[model samples]
Target chain A: MKLFSVEKPGLYTTYQDLGRVGYLKYGVPASGALDRFALQVGNILVGNERGAAGLEVTMQGPELLAEETFVMAVTGGDLSPMINGRRIPLWKSVLIKKGQVLEFGQPRQGVRAYLTVSGGFHAKKYMGSRSVYEPAGLGRKLEKGDELVGEPRQQKAGTGLFFTEIPDYDRDVDVRVVKGPHHEQISDKVVSDFFAMTHDVSPQSNRMGYRLQSDLATNHEANVISDGVPLGGIQLPGNGQPIILLADRQTTGGYTRIGTVIGPDLPLVAQLPPGGKIRFKEVSVEEAQEAAKQEEQKLRIWERFTR
Target chain B: MKITFYPLGEAAVKCCFHEDISTALTYNIQAFCKKLVHQKHVGISEWVPAYDSVAVYYDPWKLSYEEITNVLVPIANEMDAHEKKTKTVITIPTVYGSDYGPDLENLAAANKLSTKKVINLHTKRHYLINMIGFLPGFPYLSGLDERIAMPRLESPRQSVPAGSVGIAESQTGIYPLDSPGGWNIIGRTPLKLFDAEKEEPFLFEQGDYLQFTAISEDEYKQIQREIEKGTYKLERREESE
Candidate 1:
């Protein structure tokens, strides 16, 4: 059934899920929600499956008019979401009536947010996924006058998350990293300098990867044989700048990567807007794995309790 | 066939041969990938086979990094002993020169060869597929004839049409999708390199061999129509190696 009509297609809004997998070997990127935790929480709040398709709103949120009454939850970077000119709470499921308009104001916290309805958005699936990867034309961003289709439910039992469960996007984040495959190839001085300096998220950052700038400079010939690149792998090009490969990063690259940001800290890094401050701390492989396990445990616990 | 294991991240590990790029190394990597698929290790999600390495992605919740590396070491030891299997070489019908390949004349001049000679050199060899990357179904084929090999454009074109064949350095490939590319285009193919609607979306796979046969523009249009009507039969033959 028709759920919402797009009055305004906010800055680069697109439907996304967990991501497209098993096609990286064929050069297909695993384009998915950058902040996976937010998308998962949004889906769960609206009583939808964890991996259900949802609207991934960017810095500005779209003005969507509700065609039918349904339940929705907005999670991730707070863009000051509102309904019918009245402010709505973030990280909580809310009921919307027919003809009610939902929009967003200034980005008070993170730059991205996920809006998931009870039945999830019914975007056309390409290659076993609904995630919109604009480059290869697999899918596209939402445009004005587009009608969003979904499975509307009558139940309006809304849910709200605890204060401790929410993440603070306004502050500078320290992300944990594990040594990458080519870590040994980098000089000890360069590696130490990387950890010592504070990096700023470059304006050229996008879903493909985030280009970070720091004061440290080295004429390091960091080029290596082209090889498979992992998500969150920190690629150090010849200019000695770091590029954090994200959800839409290519499957393989030629540059040498020093370290990879742990999975648990990926969402935090994803939320950082342009000019946001970040620091990286090295951790053992075991420690990184343990952090991932703890994060997974939180998700499992939430899944058991909610719906 | 010694391989070293390192953590790509918490969930993925890089199994590197630490060897230079060679056909033998490519085969060993392909063979190891095949063995990996057969094992069906728990928590392993997907793997990407590149020049001299295979990156194995797994679920940290299901298995730890250390546990996965232990499973991979045994597979590496047995990979070299596997016999080489017969392969299939897929032939691509291409239309050379004119608007289909805008850079053909320029490349021919740079190499001090006639446009016809360049075409002949490009089609003479059956190139081995090193990897499929950069763009979906974009095969990084090796064995480009040195006579026709050229560097990429200084500034990449904003949009190179899909199936546009190009050469860069010692490598040659066909763009599976319309994307910004710097390679020197010399021909075009009507066959879709990538079709998301199909059961197997990608036309080429890693380890498969590719052969290019020059075709007339009219034949290109005919093949395009057949492909659109779902009547085109992909030409395939047993590897002559």
Candidate 2:
């Protein structure tokens, strides 16, 4: 049976798994969920694997019409999802029958949301991932009248699961970052200025990168021979603008990267809306790894709760 | 050669070989990359190799930054000891002049040479793939003939078509996908640089050598037809050292 049909594609809705892994050498970006924690928890609530393919709804969530009896869950942003015009709860799995329309209004919190079914999205896996990396022609964003198929599910337990602590998307966030591979290449004065700078997310920011508004200049010519870019790489182009490379960023670039946003704090950056204010906090790599460990511990706790 | 390890992020470590770009440094990177892949570690996830450095991404939950560096240091030390493998040489079929070659005249004029001379110069050298980047399957090739070198356009094209063979300064490459680029387009290739359906999506790898074979417009059409029919086999040969 058809899982759902897109009534409205919303701002942007695409299928994302953990990301396309092991393909960076070939220039494939690790295009995956922006808010991976939210996606994982959504999958956990729906009794799916952590890396299952799910819909990554942007500022506005897609309006979907279910065509079969299935269990589904919505996580990440509070997009004000409603089933047949009645408001539905976030972070909980719910049952829907045929003809029930799942409509998502304006987001109440965060920028992106995840929608997961008991079984993952039935999509083609390119290079071992279902992520929609448009440049590589792997998959595409959801459009009106587009039909999506899901794997046949037996419907296990774990419905109505709600996390005690939900992320506050509206608050200003401190994006923790580590000294980069090319950090030393930058001037000490510029590094200090970078730390002191208060930046706002550009309206042009997308899956590829978050262009931060900062007129900060580096000491040297911001050109490298071209090197592999890590996710969350804050690359300072010759234009003196900082572009935080994200999920759909090109695998490599010629611009000199000042630093990399810590993996644990990437979600904080991802949750911010356009014009969202963020401050870069330079921390030791050890501290960043410690934060990551704590975050992983939190996820593990959630994993236990969901099961 | 000193190998310095730096924290790329919370979960990955980057090892830099040297600042300069050369065949020797690239070979060292390739050799180190070979070792990392062959002797895979439990926590190691992926290795992203570029012109002068390789970033090793790992599972933070499984391994710490210190552990990752510890794992890489020895392998990096032994990289020079590893015997170099024969390189793979792939031939790219390109149709030069007219629409197939958008900036052929511009490139030739910039170098004060005839269009045919530019094409001949471009096809003469065996260009090395320093890295695959900027776009998927986009090869950053070196060894462009000095006479035909051209600077990037002052204003980049909003969108360059896929399979466009372009030259910028001392470098030449093909656009694997339609993307905004600043390179001077000299010709077009019929081969798909990247195919999502293929088991191995990319047409070339880092350290692989590329040779562009000039073809006619009719040949380009025929090759395109064969490619679409899934019958065209890319011409490749093992480079004997």
Candidate 3:
């Protein structure tokens, strides 16, 4: 069913899901929602599967015209979404009739937002995913006049997330990290200096990785033989700057990775806007796992209540 | 063949094979990956093989880091116990020199040899796919002849078309997609290295061998037509270890 038509394609809007799997060996990166937690919450609000394909809106949001009555929800980064000139609440499901126009204003919080429809966005799946990985020519950004479609799913009653469930994206975020494979290669003094410094998110940041700008300089030789790079791995190149690999990072890289951002803290890292300040804190692997367990538990609880 | 397990993060582990880069090491890693895949451990999502290590990614919620390490240790220890599998070599039909390879003349001039000599050197040896990375379906091939090896372009081309065969610093590779590259272009392949629509999206895999065969420009056009007609059959052969 035709759900909406793109009137104005906002800044870098693309369809995304949980991303492709089992193809990393072929040099494919797992391209998906940068903020996976927000996308899942949007899916839940609209009564769709957690991994449903949805629009990943950047700082700016697209202006869409509804083609039919459907339930939709916008979550993650407050880009100020509105329908028919009236503002809509984030993390809540709302129904829109045909001929209604949905648009967005200034981004008050967060760097990315997700717009999910009831049956999820019906985008072409490449290698079992609708995620748009532009470099590979898998999919391109949504453009003006593009018609958006969704599977015909029965509309459930509208719902909203509890106040406590909604994440606060407009705040100082301290991302936690675990020592990577080559963590021991660097000197202890350099490592301690790195943790003590605050970094600014470089403007060169994108889906591939976030390049951080810091004043700390080290003469450490950071180049290693190209090896497997994990998502959220913090790589230090020759310049002594750190690049945090993200959802679209290459399968292997030649730089030395100092540490990997814990899985639970990735969403917070993803939400950090350009020029945003970030601090890094080191934690043990066991502690990171415990945090992941708590996050999973919260999702499971939300899954039951949303169902 | 000692393999050490390290935590990449909560969701993945890096199995480091403390060995130098060699065809033997690649085969051993391939053998271990083959055995690991057969286990089909739940929550083990994906694994990538590199020059000297294999990174195993799994869902931490379903499987613990220790549980995955336990599953990987035995397989790494017994990897050599299994017999070596047959190797498959895929032939890539390429057109060397002329407009197809714009930098062929410049590369020949830099190496103090004719374009024909460079082409012969490139096609003589079977290159090994050490890994697939940098771009989707882009193979990091090894075994370039040192005689013709040259440095990458100081300023990379804004857009190197897909199927461009190039050489850089004792390494040769083909760009699977139209991407900005710095390698010295010497030839072009008509074959699509990656087609997302197909069941097997990538034509090459890590540990596989590739042989480039020179073809005339007319033959290239014919092969491309056959590919568009869905009638082109890739030339491949299986060699016993």
Candidate 4:
């Protein structure tokens, strides 16, 4: 039903899912929800598929007016969701009636938030995903006066869905990383300095990458043969600044990549605000695998609990 | 080609080949990529083959890095034992110089050659699709004539139109989409390299061979119209080899 009409599109709101997979060879970026954990939780709360497309509100959120009855859940950065001027709790399903306005106030924590409804947001699936990848012209950011359709009701009203452990958006973040394929190409001093320094997220950081700034001057030539760049790649351009590739990163890059953030810890970088401080810690591949396994187990338990 | 496997994050593994960019390395990369896809490895999500490396993104839940590396080693080594596959040859019609090619005169002057000679040198050799990156459907081509090798612009244009045939250093390629690039454009093609709405989405695949056939501006417009109407089909044939 075309019930959810966007009254005020927030700062950079778009529809995203679990990314468009299996198209990297064509240079397509796996555009998906930056905070996958939050998106899964939000979807599960509303009894939707894990890969279902949902609105990813960044910093600010849209003022949506519902013209029908539906169940919705807000996850990720607590963007202060409210219904009809009354604040609503996050991490749990809430009911919305006809003519009710769903609005968000200033973000209380984190940079991105996910709003998933019963029956996923209906969007044109391009290359196996409903994610809005502006580069490919698949879909674009949410604009005012846009009518969004959702699936017919497949879920009943839900309640009492809450996580015991909420992600702390204000905590000092240590982004765990595995050494990149070309880590040896850089000087040992540069590597040491990189780990020792506390980097601040640059203002220009986006879904493509997080450009970090540090006072340390890393004077090294970072000219490597162009090669495949994986998600979370910490590439150090010739300018000594480090850019950590993220969800919308290019398929390949030529700068020297020193390390890649571990999979489980990617959400920490994703949730970090523009002025957030981050320190990199190098860990073994085995450690990264263990962390990912633990995260999966936690999500599985959460999924079961919500069900 | 000697291959070495390295862990990339928790779910991906990167296979590094030779450090140099050569046709042999590209072929080895392609052979392994083809074998990997044909074998239908269970957990492999995607394989991105660039200048000298292939980064395989996989599902950690279904497969581990060690298991993936173990399966990849033998497949990479036994690539030659498998039957050699034929490549798809694609002809890209291009309009060189004038408005179609804003930098053709400067490129000719930089190479100490006439515009006609530059066009001949570019069209004489077939280009190998070494890698696909930078932008969606943008092919990184090789086999450019070193004599006409031109450096990239000091500062790249804010935006270059799609289908622009450009050269940078010793490599030549076409901008599949309107993106910011530093390559020196010498011509424009009439083909739409990327259409996200299409079922296939991409016109050319990695390892496909491309031959540029120069055409007049009028012909370029005609082909463009046909492409818009879905009447123009990109000419393709199986390589004799």
Candidate 5:
């Protein structure tokens, strides 16, 4: 059986799939990979279906020992990767020797990273996912002496291809959004300032949501009823700062929502790390849908390549 | 009439139980939610039950917003009749005061009442769990004796241990998980409020009746050990009107 054993985990790390759906009623947050784009790319490189469980490493990754599988590719968040004391290239598939020690160093760029094996790693699927939500203390994160078993694919099967560098890779990005239903409730200025201005990602950020510093000169807090909020919903609490909801955000909220991040640019927002600067550009629903269509087409084209 | 739908985007639809928040309306809305949850209507993924409003989320591809509201309004009307029907009173066994109640002295002093009198007043009123929020199974209860109504602690504690029984702004609840919270911790319950491992994670849900009993600290330790060992058998007493 092919597997990789964990050596050391750097910061916060977990085995995340796309997310846990159909369980929000139970108050369970859809815990999963923060950056779906990187996870999807990594899964595709390994010939596994997109949304497969992969190691979502924070800043740096853990040292692992491969049991049998040779080819593995890592994408998103540049980090120093070493294979058995020899430097290994990232954003491309590498030939890992049997019993080789693969270690990761500090991130050269971005906050989170993804590590994918030829076959996907195996963990207990909760509800319908294998993701580990630390807040609820579910599933497992890699630690020293821990083994990650995978459903190894045959070597002769998929092509062991590699890439030189990741495209569209960056630390921060300007997010595009569609206005919300409560958009009219808030001051015209809060909406204008949020759209026309730039904001910085606060250090107090996590998988649940990103706390963003507002560009508004003055502050106005409102006592809004807690209501349901979506993944990309931008909620400006009593404080002026806009807290952009993310993949693992609460199922509901009461704060005044500025807008949603739409579909296409969601990936770009996901790749951002704390302390990264980002701006918002408002777009109509039609524009958001068109962008989504383009992304869906891109996925379909890529699926035809190695299949 | 223009119904406010898609307020939170295509994910959810907002149906006002009433413009004003009322306990009676809360019951009516809760009844509506209970029926909806039972039906498991197509595309409706999760239904978050609250005091005066119910935020219903659905799969956009399954049904459009307008279509959902059509089905929601009619089904919600059934709640008015259902509320008048037979209602179940769920009594929750709570151990009040002592180490089980760490802030008992403080709570008593703040209310200018003896700890024994405070216990009697608290147990006398039948509480209604308006909703569950903040954390998993942290029930938001109403019906506190007006004599005991007090504001939350001036400074919210950074960490309140799990099973912490706290009161804040006329609401009482037990902390389901150990996390940073601002609730005025009056006491702690040895009973597990939430257990992800259990089939029913939340010990209490909306509309459940709560009656706290005074248990000694010695009994508190026994319950804690039982909870840890997974042998905590909670006693459910016969319902009394």
Candidate 6:
């Protein structure tokens, strides 16, 4: 099976999965989907396994040509779709016919969209991943006039695939964090003020990190060696703006982490676009993990709830 | 080689050494990383290796942070014991001037010497790999001659091409990919520091020793053509000392 060449590529379109994990030792950034939950939803809709590589089109999307037949699904954000210039709603499974043109027009709401194919695209997987790290030019962002060849679907669903209920994804999400190892070094007043303050996501934020600007006070050691930084670690620079680590962040960092946005809440952090405002509440490590499991359970229940 | 355990998150623990980067410390990280990857520990997914530290991501249900840290101390000490046996030396070939090496003359003049002198001093020293980071396969090499210390460019260029030999902050490194960089370019090497197409994408790994040798522009072109033709072979450096 084959996917058509891109007639018009919009914004940033790239291949992504859960990410390139276990390669930080050689300084490879773990490049993956910004919103893993959204990506999973898209994959699940098409009956693809979670963590399978797919198209992560941000806000504006590419105009694609479909060369062969396959069950495709789009999940994430509120972006209107068009098949051969006809309007189609998002978050629902759509059967793409052979030689038809598919495109995502202007984003009416969310900043990201996830599109998943049946068997996943046939891309060269490096280090057990097909996620492209654009900076490294390994698996690059899908560019204009690029022909995409997809792998054949492995599962034969004798009954054509379709999902009845669209997922209920809340745009407004609150993320919780755990106080970091260096949290105490930063004043208690700052910690208290941080929880009290609400921050707006700066335009400066991207896959590498999320930079938030707020009235919250900040502090950092001028001379510090780099250390292994966990995902969602909130580091406050000397300038007072807080930077949260993401999938493509460096293996180690020199900044001071005020808190670590727990694992479960990391998906919430990923969905935030520039100018998004949010606040963080502190929780214990044990509580963080428990919340993660609970959050996972809630996600599983989302499908059942709609059904 | 000995490291203290610190909890990074519920699923991972960081093993950090005391301040300072060196060969011995890098070796310790290598040995520990080797062990962690091979062991069938419950919940331990993978360990990320670095110059003076290792970030071990594990499953909380299988192994606690305390358990991984407790197992790491003895292995860290053991890596130091076998450092001599695992020590490896690698040499890189470089060409001095022309279109390939754009900033060679400037770096040579800044050091109050001819371009030849700069190349001689750079190639003469046997440098140790401190760590690999900043970019894929980009190594932070220590033991540079203090005389050639040069600060990074006042304003970094938007893209420094691959295999660009650069110096900054009394240290030297090669740009593995075309990225926004400020390092002072001394010369360019035709060697592929990074190649995603290969079995081992990175030609050089952490903790390995490196030596540079001077080559001609013709030789550079020859290597480039051969590399494109898939017949280029780089000479290996024998490791004893």
Give the interface RMSD values of the models in order: 0.8, 1.1, 0.9, 0.9, 3.0, 2.2
lDDT of each: 0.90, 0.85, 0.88, 0.87, 0.71, 0.75
Q: Which ten residues in a row have the lowest lDDT in candidate 1 chain B?
A: B79-88
Q: Mind giving the per-residue lDDT tens digits that candidate 2 earns over B136-211?
A: 8888888988898888999999998899999888889999888898999989999999988887777778888999
lDDT agreement of model 4 with the native:
0.87
Q: Which residue pairs come into collision in candidate 2?
A: none
Q: Best candidate per TM-score, number?
A: 1
Which lDDT tens digits does candidate 1 get at residues B39-104? 887899899999999999999999987799888888888867547767779999999999999999
What digit string (tens of lDDT, one per residue) describes model 1 on residues A1-307? 9999999999999999999989999999999999999999888888788999998999988999999988999999999999999989999999999999999999999899999999899899998899999888888998999999989677765598888989988548899999877877778888899998889999999999999987456666788888899999999987877999999999999999999999889988888999988899999999999999998898878877776
Model 1 residue-pair collision total:
0
| Model 1, runs deviating above 4 Å | none
TM-score of chain A of 6: 0.88
lDDT of 3 by residue, A1-307 (tens): 8999999999999999988999999998899999999998888888778998999999989999999988899999999999999999999999888999999999999989999998899899999999999988889999999999987566764698888878888446788998878877777877898898888888899999999987556666787878889988999886878999999999899988889999888888888888887889999887888888898888778878877
Candidate DockQ values, in order, are 0.87, 0.81, 0.81, 0.81, 0.28, 0.41
User: Residues A83-105, candidate 2, lDDT per residue (tens digit)?
Assistant: 99998888888888789999888
Q: TM-score-based ranking, best first?
A: 1, 3, 4, 2, 6, 5
The better candidate by lDDT, 5 or 6, is: 6
Q: What is the lDDT of residue B67 in candidate 5?
A: 74
lDDT of 2 at B131: 88
Candidate 5 structure quality by residue, lDDT tens digits, B1-241: 1124444443556665544655666667677777787888888877777666677766555666567888887776566553344444554455776555667778889889997887788768767777666666666678888777668777777878887777776777777778887766766777877676766666656666677766777877887898789887776444533
Residue-level error in angstroms, candidate 4, position A250: 0.6
Every candidate's fraction of true contacts kept comes to 0.83, 0.85, 0.76, 0.79, 0.16, 0.35
lDDT of model 3 at position B54: 92
Worst 10 residues of 4 chain A by lDDT: A154-163
Tell how far residue B237 is off in model 1, in angstroms.
1.7
lDDT per residue as tens, model 4, A85-151: 9998888888988899999998888889999988889888999999999987879999999998987
Model 3 DockQ class: high
Better of 2 and 3 by TM-score: 3
